[model samples]
Target chain A: MTPPPALPPLLDLTGIAVFALSGALLAAKMRQTIVSVVFFALVTGVGGGSVRDLLIDAPVFWVRDPWVAPVILMIAFITWFTPSRWWEGKMLDWADAVGLAVYSVLGTAKALAYGVAPVPAILMGVITGCVGGIIRDVLAGRPSILMRPELYVTAAALSATMCALGTLAGLPLFTVWAIAAVAGFCLRGAALIWNIELPAYSRDP
Target chain B: MTPPPALPPLLDLTGIAVFALSGALLAAKMRQTIVSVVFFALVTGVGGGSVRDLLIDAPVFWVRDPWVAPVILMIAFITWFTPSRWWEGKMLDWADAVGLAVYSVLGTAKALAYGVAPVPAILMGVITGCVGGIIRDVLAGRPSILMRPELYVTAAALSATMCALGTLAGLPLFTVWAIAAVAGFCLRGAALIWNIELPAYSRDP
Candidate 1:
């Protein structure tokens, strides 16, 4: 069988770095120890991809990757030394939006390459993009994004679904990937700008 | 290459039912709908073991087992119809302690059977006993047990360590399992009765 399609190495590292930064920043803001910051960064960097791999019966990516842990550690050190306020603006969110889009699309592509069905492959992508943040919030004893009727998870689902559909339509691989990434990034970026939120069930309108 | 030791089917079911009940009961107490209640039961019932299986590269148990889903669904139905007050006493805690101990031991045994090293195998057991509740609490927007300076994780760790040590010492599997479960349950039981908690770092006592 042909090897599964690979995510571009630079984009993959950017995703992990972006995620690690968010986790480390949270810990630093909370005045947690350097160890906690590092631990948080490590989990957030790898949590989503790890869970996706597990669900898809694939080898866990970070366990074998030499660079993943070091990248997370470096992120932690950066957070530990820097003022948390430096990360408290829209810049981090924008970077995270990009990471979410890229990872979700690529994760779906990888799952599809591994023979997963479209629906599950899309869910796999959603898991790959969103689970790390959920884990970080949980560990920090903060409200998880999943608990909010926000566009975050929706953005991930959008990217994953788009990738699955594009593949199903026999679109060119790189073109589909680019479109899916841009679509998700745009939605998430819009959410950050407008503070968009889905109405709670109680609102119904 | 002997097949990995099988947890007694009855005991396995009991552990799952107990965990499922805890999750369902939590959702029910919060006045969540039947759908949420059932979803909680499903996650709590299989969360720990699923993580363990994934980490060990074993096929996920519930994904293939027809019985597990049915049991969790049954638990959801039971919780939905029952008054939440009916489970308000310490009885549930006691039952959860048993489930924790039994599952932790069995999880470690299975991981060891998969040729996981001692330390990671022990951690597998703790993950099996604890992660379901963590996921449930996280999803519900509640402070998870991990944030508490409680004996819950400690009990799981003790049982897991005991199992690993016993196996290393060449003891009979059944005897080791029995001792590990009892040790863990007893510690957890004592914690409940005494309202025991570990000292926080600041307390340092």
Candidate 2:
């Protein structure tokens, strides 16, 4: 078999940092203890991919690479020590959007690289992007975003589609990342700005 | 292959109801919506075994036997509509202990019957007994009982050992169940009454 194309370590690092920050912010909001916050960050940063690996009988990623855990912990510690009031504005929202965008593209790329069929690859992307946050919310005893009419999953789906299409068209890796990240960021940003949501069904008496 | 031993439907029904009740009680404490309450109950009651089956490549028990879902749902509905205070106090604790005891023995028995070694079987029993509650606590955003200094895991381990020993000694199934269940119940009850906790280590200066 031909060797698989290499991905930039910078791209992976960016995605991991963003995802870890998102998890830390959520844990901070929940007022979790320092240890719990760090645990949540680590789990949210890696939980989906871990589950995917386990299901596919692959060696778990973090077990092979110890760097992921320390990076997540560092992010968690920074978030925990930082005052909430310092982050209580558009900056927080923007950081979250960036994290979502990065994670979506990364998930799609990883799934494709794993040689999964297109459909399962796309599903895995969505699963990888959203499951970590869903788990975070579940652990916080909040309604999972999946049960809500948020633009989160829609943003992920769009980004994943872009990544898959770009890969199939033999686009450069950086180009694929740029396009997919822009799509996810724009979609999610617009949703937050306009309070956009999926239409709800009303139960009539 | 030798013919599989027959398992009575009544025992299955009883186990399902007991587990469902425990799940429902936890959901009520968490104040989840009706749909979430029912969903939690069903998942908690069947999830551990389903995970074990999936990992072991066994046909999922509920998939093969459809009756389990309905029984769980029925119990959930009953718990939902019942007076909130009805199952409170000592009764709820008793119910929880009973559910844990039954599930632990059932897990051990199932693992042994499937020809798993004694060590894995006992571990499976502890997992099956504790995982549902862990998932429940995680989703409810509470510190899992496993994370706390409690007699929870200890009780399950003891009961599982008894069941494994009983099977090795050629004791009757019901006798094993009785011995394991009573031991588990008493241990858990003691923990509850005494606020027993595991020792926590303090950081050195």
Best candidate (score: DockQ): 1
- Report the number of the highest-lDDT candidate: 1
Residues A132-202, candidate 2: write the lDDT tens digits.
Answer: 77877776667887898978889888888898899889998889878998999999999999988988788
Q: Write the per-residue lDDT of candidate 2 for residues B35-149, one digit (tens) a residue.
A: 8879888877887677555433457788768788888888888888987788887776677677787778877777777766665567567667776777877767677755455
TM-scores of the models, in the order given: 0.62, 0.56
Name the DockQ score for candidate 2: 0.06
Point out the worst 10-residue segment of candidate 2 chain B by lDDT.
Answer: B196-205
Q: Model 1, residue B19: displacement in angstroms? A: 1.1
| RMSD after CA superposition, every candidate | 6.7, 8.8
Chain B TM-scores, listed for every candidate in order, come to 0.95, 0.90
lDDT of 2 at B1: 24
Q: Give the residue spans of candidate 2 off by over 4 A.
A: A1-4, A55-57, A201-205, B1-133, B138-205
Docking quality tier of model 2: incorrect
lDDT of 1 at A77: 87
On the 0 to 100 scale, the lDDT of residue B52 in model 2 is 51
lDDT of 1: 0.83
Task: Write candidate 1's Cα lDDT for B110-170 as tens digits.
Answer: 9888777676677679889888888888899887766665688788888999999999999
